[model samples]
Target chain A: AQSVTQPDIHITVSEGASLELRCNYSYGATPYLFWYVQSPGQGLQLLLKYFSGDTLVQGIKGFEAEFKRSQSSFNLRKPSVHWSDAAEYFCASKGNTDKLIFGTGTRLQVFP
Target chain B: EPEVTQTPSHQVTQMGQEVILRCVPISNHLYFYWYRQILGQKVEFLVSFYNNEISEKSEIFDDQFSVERPDGSNFTLKIRSTKLEDSAMYFCASSANSGSYNEQFFGPGTRLTVL
Candidate 1:
């Protein structure tokens, strides 16, 4: 079965600091990876995705993700995090199916 | 900008009652999907619809659950008998295509609370 994993359950970072949320996936073939963020009481919003060719993909709200085939990882990164960036981040993948398999999610807390 | 929209932002229901969640996918999109997330669990896919029929469904979507696109703009998911375990945030998503690379835009979601 294909699965996506986010090792960190919760992470705290100071405002204006750099942020990196880790993600790993298991699939038989090259998977289409994605990162989504959900604020409290809000729906999941797509941050970025990785399909082919480009290992580093840019997304809305100054977010970026790098897809590493060797490690089966697609990690999300953002420079100079703002207080509004505090949200739950989820990593997802699609493999052989249209259904997206999502990670458990990592709650990010931005401190001033 | 076009985006998926779901009705009844929040719903409260009793066990064994029937509940229907409605959604209006993007006008030009051809694929629709339903997913749910428990309070502290990962989001799980429920089912996908294309060409007015169910293309795929997950194990969690049992006999009690059914999906229908009754009209050109409305897609609905109905639970024959709601269960307490069904309490979760249900999201509706639509994509222009069915390929793996196509991005699926999600709706605000309907939070269902079954008591």
Candidate 2:
């Protein structure tokens, strides 16, 4: 079975500070990884995705993720996070069975 | 830019009642999907539809749930008996192609509250 794990349940970061959210997955083959953000009461917004080739993939809203196959990790990072960046972050991996398994999610709290 | 859209931003229903959630996927998309997120839990996949038929469905998708593309633009999910556990944000997504790497555009979601 394929599963995604986001270690951080909640994270607080100051505005303009760098941010890194950890994600790990268990899969048998090379997995398709994705990062999504959801504001309170809003639907998910895709951040980035990794299918093949490049380990580092850039996404919308100044977000990026690096896929590490050896570690089974796909971590999301942002050089500088604005206060508006506060939201719930989820890491997901495509399952062969026809669904994307999502992580429990990490609530990002950005402080001034 | 094209995006998926869902009807009924929120629906309050009684237990055992039937509820239908509607979604209008991106016009040019060929695949549609349904997923839900229970409060404080991970988002879970329910089913996927393509070519006017179900391509795949998850274990969470049981006999109680069914999906239909009644028209060219509308994709609907019907729950036969609403349970308290069914209360969650239901999201509709669509992709131009069927692949793990294809981008799936999501809608605002409809919050289903079963009382």
- The DockQ assigned to candidate 2 is 0.74
- Residue A105 CA error for candidate 1 (Å)? 0.4
Q: After superposition, how far is residue B49 of candidate 2 from its true place, in Å?
A: 0.6
Per-residue lDDT over A29-69 for candidate 2, one digit per residue giving the tens place of the 0 to 100 score: 98889999999888899999998998999999999999998
lDDT of 1 by residue, A1-112 (tens): 8999999999999999999999999999999999999999898899988889989999989999999999999999999899999999999999877899999999999999
Report residue A26 deviation for candidate 1 (angstroms). Answer: 0.4
Candidate 1: give the clashing pairs. none
Model 2 TM-score, all chains together: 0.98
True-contact fraction per candidate equals 0.83, 0.76
Task: Please compute the TM-score of chain B alone for each predicted structure, in the order given.
Answer: 0.97, 0.97
As for candidate 2, its clashing pairs are: none
Off by over 4 Å in 2: none
Q: Provide the RMSD of all predictions against the true structure, rounded to 1 decimal.
A: 0.7, 1.0
Q: Which stretches of candidate 1 lie above 4 Å from their native place?
A: none
* Every model's TM-score: 0.98, 0.98
